[model samples]
Target chain A: MTFGETLAEAWGPLREDAIQTDAYLEMLLAGATAGAAPTGDLPTVEGTALIDPALVGAARALRDALVRIHPSFRFEERLAGRLRAAVDGVALPRAAGDPIPFRSRPTDAAPGPIPGDVVAVGRLSVLAPSLPEPLDRLPRPVLIGGAIASGVSLAGVALVAWRRRPGRH
Target chain B: MPVFGRMRRGAPADRIAVYDTDRAAVRAAGRDPRQFEALYRKYLPQVYSFAFYELGNHHDAEDVTERTFLSALAALPRFEERGDGPSTFRVWLFRIARNAISNHRRSLARRREAPAELADALPAPLDPEHLAAERESVARAWAAVARLPADRRRALILRFVEEMSTAEIARVMERSEGAVRVLVHRALRTVARELGARREGDARQRR
Candidate 1:
């Protein structure tokens, strides 16, 4: 189909998606706020109000352009700038290591070497625990043993004091 | 698991900024959900657009977008701001999106559908002058994108459409940024060459 036709077909869905996104974000806002009470013990409330309609509108604009533009036009630099402003303190970085090349999946006919970015990120995920808490959940055995040792020493000191009391001697 | 005992030097300034911002947002999220709402509002667009471009379907994109935030919220309490200098959050979010899309593709063999009817009113024959004015290339460049291998298509979409940097792309692609750059560069050259060939064909027809 022609590019216009492709765009035309995609526009309705895209706009719908945008609206849906707004609603979803609203839901998230409501849910998050509902859980945090009015006078809760959270940090300073500075910079939280920045996610306004304006930011959403900018995001929509960027989304529309991405769908509309040709693949050859690189928009990373410009897009990063725009997103930086919209999110107000968020910066998205590109992969900076040596190129690993693109390798296709063996099962599909998609296309050399798998892109290193994917592998590196995966490696981090594998290495980094998804949970913020360390898997070092169980108490350190050595520390526990030390605590026991300290307790025994304290008990011995108490016994010696009782035995050396003047009246008992 | 390559632990750089210290943070890398010469990282993107924006990355540091993003980490700083997310650190506060994440901390707020842990303490108060409302505060986290602030972050949701802030990053939703970036997250949503990234999912949309990568997934290419309205329903799946939204699903993934919602899932990304929900998961982020659930996991927020433990999120540490490594101060890696860029919003690894966006990368983290996109990685979630990439996984969602990949899973769907694997399960359903997701194919690109024609753009919806809403695009019917769009003008055809992309104005070269308009594109040039924007420093944008010809519209035909997309056709080449359409013709790319699936993995390459994902890389191009992330690089061109989502406008993710090589490192961010690497995070999303689970590959090194260099790989992403190489893939993107080759993809662009391929698309340009494809367009050039098409133009030559048109000239021959005229002759």
Candidate 2:
């Protein structure tokens, strides 16, 4: 393999700390020897000469160049200031008697009834049974008239129910 | 083994401890907005640097950074902590920054304005007298990075510039760890080849 390909292959492992120097040297040596023809069980001379320090140096130099060119902008103070203002805006103090902000919760969990709705329901429940007490205190003539009216109303309701009842036809 | 198990095994114990501490801080921030200062202080530089590098200008970077933090603060209440790891917060925050950058880029494209060069994005104080000395190499490197495929360039920047680990990068990039590694590998190879070719051309020019 060419020096560039060899460096590329070794660069990731070396940079990521996955391989130590010994492993790198072994890999380089293997790459160097891969193309040599075997001469009948003879011990091949270790070709350490093919391992040029210049290739590794060049790779490291390139990495350094790239890193040096990484633009450093000092926007921390400005950004933090902006974030502080934004956070303050979001976390503003609630006014007295203000309702708590609505937060999303699980769909299966039902939300509690509103306070105003609860108060209206309570007032209705309390007033429903006492509604007839005022009518009971009417004068005798008025009470008699009310009874006659109630009877007429009951008769009207019975006629309507009978008309609408099933099998009436 | 679970995916997190592999990550945990690969990560140093101290790193995991720091991650846990950061996660706790995030949870505290969720409960009390005042506590969010800790997170904002901690990740401000990282997020800012990422935005600056990605967008290649401080103005846009600051704008995006502000939007990212504001959006994060607004959404903090809904941030659920499953006791997974600190990567959750990093990933979530970076996703916000990435989207902001994308929107900024789209707007710029609509306006027909090109992003400034990476070197031009440096702050005034960083523009040393010797900047001209290293301009050629820096330009070549920046150009190579710009020419890379989008995902590959992002992966490379997150890996080298942000000094993020593969697992963290995968979380931010929303890719598998294997895919991130392949991207970095290919990106590095491309960059090396480009630099080598440039050097050869320079040599020929000198001759």
By TM-score, who's the top model here?
2
Against the unseen true structure, what C-alpha lDDT does each candidate score?
A: 0.46, 0.54
DockQ, cand. 1: 0.02
The two-chain DockQ for each candidate, comma-separated, is 0.02, 0.06
Model 1: residues with Cα > 4 Å off, grouped in runs: A1-169, B1-19, B81-87, B113-139
Candidate 2 lDDT by residue in tens digits, A30-77: 433464332222232344233234443333433444452322323453
- Write down the worst ten-residue block by lDDT for model 2 chain B: B1-10
Question: What lDDT, from 0 to 1, does candidate 2 have?
Answer: 0.54
Interface RMSD of each: 17.8, 11.9
lDDT of 1 by residue, B61-136 (tens): 5566555665555454444435443446666666666776677666666465523311332345477566542222
Give each model a TM-score.
Answer: 0.44, 0.54
* Number of the top lDDT candidate: 2
